[model samples]
Structure formats: structure tokens, C-alpha cells
Target: MTLQIDGLTKRFGGQAVVDGLSIDIAEAEFFAIVGASGCGKSTLLRLIAGLETADAGSIRLHGEPVSGPGLHVPPEGRGFGVVFQSYALWPHLDVRGNVAFPIETAGASRNDAARAADRHLATVALQPFATRRPAELSGGQRQRVALARCLAQGARTILMDEPLANLDPHLRGAMERELLAFHAASGATTLYITHDQREAMAVADRMAVMSAGRFLQVGTPQEIYERPASEEIARFIGQGVVLPVEIAQGTALIAGQRVFLRVLNGAETGPRSAMLRPSDITATDPGAEGAVAGRTLSVLYRGGLWEALVAVEGLAEPLPVHLNRPARAGEAIGLRLTGGWLLPEAAMAAKAPRRAAASAP
Candidate 1:
């Protein structure tokens, strides 16, 4: 492992923001930590970068202790590169100068540093903008410069904190590609933090879903999406609906129809929650096997496909479905569940108190 954290915890005013977190990140692997705002992801990054002192935990990088009890290394001494959301370029220096500055600080001669900077800038395809100052470059270009500076520093580990948050949607897509290219070229261990689950899915080899100072689950994007560990994670990672259901003998009883259930998390015969994604349910012929009658509660055209919510008898919430054509409100429809995951019994039990509290009044 290139980075290993154990028992990591940080607090503010008696509230734990990062509570007993542990993860092993392999060298040159891209790992993403995704969660909503105030989930302690950024603070976790700062701890790894040595910008914030961990109240309790051990941070080991390639067998060296950077952070632990009675030991702390400053950010500069860690030799890791950090990219912030704002890009953090020096206004006074041109692109080439900005990239060269780190090398010069590491004891390279001025002329030697400039030559090395040009080589690094070429890696990011920004050699042509070497003379442009930070103010003269677009947001994307400035971001490349930051990356080039990281290359010039020869950093083997890079930490990025929502680096694309400042860009527009279009640029964000472009930068996502650019970031993958940069990672391939650098081969550095990357720990990326983002609130955007889609972006994390796009760039990460693996991702962790965090909430309220703890990691709820961590796995490949597909694994997390298709087989979420809990109801909270199922709703957070992607579009889906969790409806109450009864399970028996590897099948689920939903809306007066029996459908094969993809049992996950060792859910047994009992009342549980079924997680159905838009793709899991499809329009089928009326009275087909495992088909359930429903009504279109609402529909919206999403470019190429129509997204609709369907209310089925005996189901509490509407299940989301996709259609090839327009759907009308209150129109009768037939839907079949081709596949769905069952939430574990423990997760269903854990949710009972909250559900009870909300219905108490």
C-alpha cells in the first residue's frame, strides 16, 4: 500500500467530524471519496496532506510515518502534491515560472528548472501557454498548469479536493478526461474527493461513500451502484427507489407479483426493502409473467428518453421507469421487474426507528 490510514479521527467542539476511518490506498491507484457537503471528506484530505493535525490516527506513506501520535510532518516535508478547487496559481508568475518555481525551491538552478518545467508543461499539452500569466489563461488552462507543477515536483502522491467544482458542466466533462490522461501519464497514487457521485464514477478505480464522519461503504462504482450495502447508500449513489417488500425462497413479493430477487448482504426470508433502479423495471406486455399493473404519476422528457414515475398497487413509493415514448398522467401501464437488489435485514431494522420518529406526530 502506498497510503494507509488507521483509526483516523478528528473532532470539533466535541463533535466527531471524521470518526475512526481506515483505508488502504495502493500505489498509482485512483481512489475517490465521495459524499455530500460537510461529510468530512475535505478534512480527511487535509489530514493526509499534513495541513491538519489528526487528533487520533496513523498515516503511513510507503512505510514512512507522516502522521501519528506525537509525530507530525509539515505539508512541505511530505513531498506530495495538492490541487485545490481554486487552482491556487501564483498571479505574478507566468505558466512556465509557476511550474519551475517548485523545482527551483528543491535546489535546481534557475535555467535547469526552466528546462524541466517546459518538459512537464509539454506533458499536460500546455507548453504553448508557458509565457501566459495565470490571469491570462482560462480556467482549464490554469488547472493544467497546476498539474504540470505537480509533475515538475515529481510528486508520487497527489491529493485533489473537488478540483473541478469551479468549472462549468461542459468544462467539467472535458477536465474529467484530462484528469484521467494526467493520471495515466503520472502514475501517481491519487486520492480525489468530490461531492459529485457521477464525476467520481467517471474517474475513480474505486470509491467510498461517506456520511456524517464515517464511510458507509467502499467498492468499485459498479458494485456500489448495483449492490449498495444499505438503504442510505442505495438512495445516495444513484437514482433508485427503495420500496417495502416480502421475501421468501429467493423470490420477492412486490405489488402482488412474484419476481426473482438478487439477494445481497445476506437478506433472508422476511420483510425487507427492494432497491429498483430505472433499468431494473421495464415496460412489458400486460398480464406478462411477473408483470404488475401501474399508473403513470408523472413523466418528463430527458433528451432521448422519457423518465416516468409509476405508482403500483401495494407499493408505498412510485418506482422510476424509462420509456421510449411520451407517457401521460394517470395512464395505465404494465411493468415487469427484471432484476432488483434486496437490502439486508439489518439495514431495514436500522431504519425502523427513524421511520417511526418521522411518523410519530
Candidate 2:
């Protein structure tokens, strides 16, 4: 393992922000931790970077202990690079100086440090801005400079905490691509923290969904999207509706219609909760067999296609569907559910009482 954390915990004001988390990251892998605000994702990153001490447990890099019982290594001694949302560049220094400062501090001559800085700047395609001050560069360009500095430091691992959160939507997309290229060029293990699930899915080799100081689930992006471990995870990772379903003989019964059910983690025959994504349901002819009748409750045009929420009989929440044409409010439509994932029995049990109370009146 390139990075290993075991039973790590951190607390503030008698509240545990990070609670007994453990994960192993392979060399040169891009691992992402995603969660809502105050879920302790950032604090986890800080612990790994040595910015904050662990109240309990151990942190290791390449079989060496960096943080543990009665042992704490400073951030500068960890040989790991950290990039924050603020970029953390020096205001008085130009781009080249910012990248070369770490090398100079490590006992490199000025000429050697400048040459190494230029090489890393070229790697991020920021050589043109080498003479510009941090304040003079755009947000995206400054982020690239930070990445270049990481490369110049010869860091074997990098920790990023919402590094692109300050950028506009359009620029964020562009910088995401730049980050992938930087990771490939540097060949360093990366631990990224983000609130945006979309960004995490786009860049991660594998991701963990965190909540309330613990990891709910960890897997590839597709696995997390297709086979969420709980109702909360399904609702948080993407746009979806979880409906009560009855399963028998490998099929699901929802709204008086039989649909194919992909059993992910539960018994094949029983009452369960089914998570239905937009891709699982499709518009069909109203009179088609096995099609459920519904009313369009709302619609929004999303670029080339239309998105709608459909209210089906016997279901509590409206199901989201993608349409090739416009749909109006209160219009009648037929939907065929081709596929869905069944939630495990534990998740259903955990949520049943709250749902029963909510629907009581």
C-alpha cells in the first residue's frame, strides 16, 4: 500500500468529526472521498497531511509511521504535497519563484531550482505565466501553478481539498482535465476531497461516500451509482427515487407493473426498496403491456433533452424520466421500468419506521 490509515479518529468540542476510518490507497492511484458539508472529509485529508494530529489510530506511508501513538511528523517532513482551495501561493513571488521555493529550501542552488521549476511549469502548460505574480494569474492558471509546485517538490503523494471549488462552472470542467494530466505526469498517489459527486465520479479510480464521521460505502463510481448500500447513499450520489417494491421469482412488482430487478445485496424474494434511476425507466406507448400509467408533474429542458418528474399511482414520490421531446405538466404518459437495484434488507429495516411515521398524516 502506498498510503494506509487504520482506526483514525479526530474530535472537536467533544464531537467526533472523524470516527475510526480505515482505507488503503495503492501507488499512483487517484482516490476520492466525497460527502456533504461537515461530514469530516476535509478533516480526514488534514490528518493524512499532518496538518492536524490524530487523537487516536495510525497513519503510514510506505510502511513508515508518520503519525501514531506519541509520534507526530510535521507537514514539511512528510514529503507529501498539499493543495488547498486558496492555492496558498506567495503574493510577492512570481509563478516560477513559487514553484522553486520548496526546492531552494531543500538545499538546491538557485540555478538548479529555476531549471527544475521551468520543467515542471512546462508539464502543466503554465510556462507562459512563469513571470506573472499569483495575483495577476487567473484562478485556473494559479491552480496549475500549485500543481506544478507539487511536481517540483518530487512529492510521492498529494492531498487536494476541494482545489477547484473556487472556480466557475465552465472553468471547473477545464481544470478537472488539467488535474488528470497532472496526476499522470507526476505519477503520485492522490487523495481528493470534494462535495460534488459528479467531480468525484469523473476523476476517481475508486471513491468512498462518507456521512456523519464514517464511510457509508466505498467502490468504483459505477458500483456506487448502481449498487448504493443504503437509501441515504442512493439519494446522495445521484438523482433517483426509491419506491417500495415486492419481489418474487426474480422480478419486482411496482405500481401493478412487473419489471426486471437487479438484486445487488439482498434476498431475491421479499418486500424491499427499489432504487430507480432515470436510465432505468423509459417512455412508451400508453397502451403497451407491462407499462405503468403516470401523470407528468413537472418538466425542465436540459440542453438537448427534457427531464420530467412523473407521478405514478401507488408510489409516494414522483419518478424522474428523460424525454426526447417536450412534456407538459399534468399530461398523461406511460413508463416502462426496464431495470432497478434492490436495497438490502438492513437498509429497508432502518428506514421503515421513519417512512411509516411520515406518511401517517
Candidate 3:
């Protein structure tokens, strides 16, 4: 299944929810849409699912136009299945019955539906609990059953809307892997939505970071991480800090000196903000190349990392540097700021309205 959104706009009372959103989703690829709540991420999914209407613009499923008042395709007719955050399984139905429901609705024989249900349940590793009702299943088990049912429904495309939201941290991680495995095995064109940066980065083949209703940036995980288009994109992706650093030509003005750093964008000279990733900052000897000395103000363990708050000269406040090597608090150390880019703040702010839209039901 492939999806194409061309100027797809959804509005409520004259406010655009999806704005002029255009995206092309390829068949057998996992595409993730990420955004904060109230940013219309879920509404976009609903629009694609035919659960809601777009006030303007177009949505194409395999290149067929979709929208308008009476000309509508319900969820079932869209050839898609959804795995919601709540699982949405019938409490009174057993696992087998729940998984077989869609097939039964399509007029499959009793034995055939049961056989298909059992097969799909096995795919999700939940066949052992076929007779168990949703009330008797664990959270992760119920989620797997939901996935089983989605697969059994013969959906060409799967829309997973934050399906891992209700799981615990450990379960979230486990389920993330399971979803990837399931997607890999099924080779279904999957579109997933999430607010979790790490989750989007970890699983998606490619993802679009959104804010207000607009896509901040769309690229591979590495492209979005190593070279973000703006400060907001950098911050949303959760990397090093973006500081207000002045730029001159190809060099940045810091510590009262023009220091050279990498520039992904060819902008030279003028006021700008440079993005510094946590892992990019390093502790080095005084004579080491590009070293900037600073006094450590604080130190904290970050998993396998050691983060320290250090005061570098020529900066108003202390700059937070992430060091892999352990450092003592209050220790005088030489710091180096390397591997970041100076970006225009205004460029990112301009993308907001083009992204946000009206509310969805």
C-alpha cells in the first residue's frame, strides 16, 4: 500500500489542522509521523484512515483521490487496520473470537476463520491464550492480540497510533522490537505515529518531525540527528544544546576568538545559533587542538556518560558539556566545542503555521 497526501488540509471553523501537508509513503516501507499532542499528528492518521474528512486538499491511497461530504471511504473500505493505544479489544470476546471477527464479517467459514485467527495469533506469539478473554490477559499480551487481529483482518497497510503508549518502559522497549519484527515479517506499508523521539529514531526507516501541524524536517535518522535543519528540529531530536553563538564567515565568535566549526549549510558571516550535540563536546588536554578551558560547575552520570556544567570564557552563562571520561565537580578543565553548525532561528519559526491545523474529533 502507498499513500500520497497533496496539499492535504483539514480545518475546523476556519483553522487548518493538517495545513498543506504533502507526503509520499512507499509500499512495504515503515514511515513514522512524529509530533507533540495538539499538533494534529493523530488527526493526520485519522484523515488517512478515512475516519475524518479534510476541509480542503487531497489524500490518495495508491493514487486514488479521497475526501468530501458524501464521497467517503469508511475505515473498513480503506484496506487498513489500526492498532490503537488502548488496544480496543472486546472485553467479552476471547482472543480467538476477537482475531476472527473481521474475517467472519467478510463471510469466511467458521473453520477457516478459526484457522486464520490461530495462525495470526501464532505470528504474534499469543496462540497459547486463544481461549482467554481480554480481561485475563496482561497488557503486552493484549497488545499482541490487537496486532494479531489487525493482521488477521487482511489490512494492506497498518496504522499504529502510539500503540506503545500504555506499556511500561521495559514493555515499551520489548514491544518496539516486536513491532519492528512484525513489520519486517509482514512487509506491510506501515505508518506509525509517536511523540517519542528515541522510538521514532530507533524504528522508522525515515520519519517526519512535526510541530504545530507542520513538518519540521523529514529525513533518515542520521540526517535528522547529525545535521538538523533548525534549532527546533535539533532540540526535538534530543541531541546537544543549541546556543546563541555569533557567526563570522565560516567561523563562530566564541571566547572572544573566531573559532572554526563544521557548517552543513553554506551560510557564512552574521548572527546565528550553533547546535552542539552532547556527545560532540569532549574533555582534552590544555594544548589539544580546539580546546577551550572552563571550570566545571556540576557533574552527573548519564547512563554510560558523564555530563558536566562548565563555564567557558566569552560566554555569559556556563555551557553544558557531555564528557565520556569521568570528571570531578569543580575541576578546572579545558573544553572543546566541535561538530556543530550555526543556523538561523527565524527559518524554523517560519514553518509553524504551514504545519498546524484545526482540531480533529
Point to the candidate with the largest lDDT: 2
Q: TM-score-based ranking, best first? A: 2, 1, 3
Instruction: Tell me which of candidates 1 and 2 scores higher on lDDT.
Output: 2
RMSD of each: 6.2, 6.3, 4.4
After superposition, the stretches of candidate 1 with alpha carbons farther than 4 Å from their true spots are 265-267, 285-290, 347-361
Inter-residue clash pairs, candidate 2: none
Answer with 2 or 3, whichever has the higher lDDT.
2
TM-score of each: 0.92, 0.93, 0.87
Instruction: Give lDDT tens digits, candidate 2, residues 175-259.
Output: 9899998988888989899999999998988888999888888778898999888888999998899988878865887888788
- Sort all candidates by lDDT, best to worst: 2, 1, 3
| Model 1: lDDT of residue 136 | 96
Against the hidden true structure, what lDDT does model 2 obtain? 0.88
* Candidate 3 lDDT, 44-89, residue by residue in tens: 9999898998776777787676654456677767888898999999
**Winning candidate number (TM-score):** 2
Candidate 3 Cα errors over 4 Å, as ranges: 68-70, 256-260, 265-267, 285-290, 296-298, 316-318, 325-331, 344-361
Off by over 4 Å in 2: 265-267, 287-289, 347-361
In order, how many clashes per candidate?
0, 0, 11
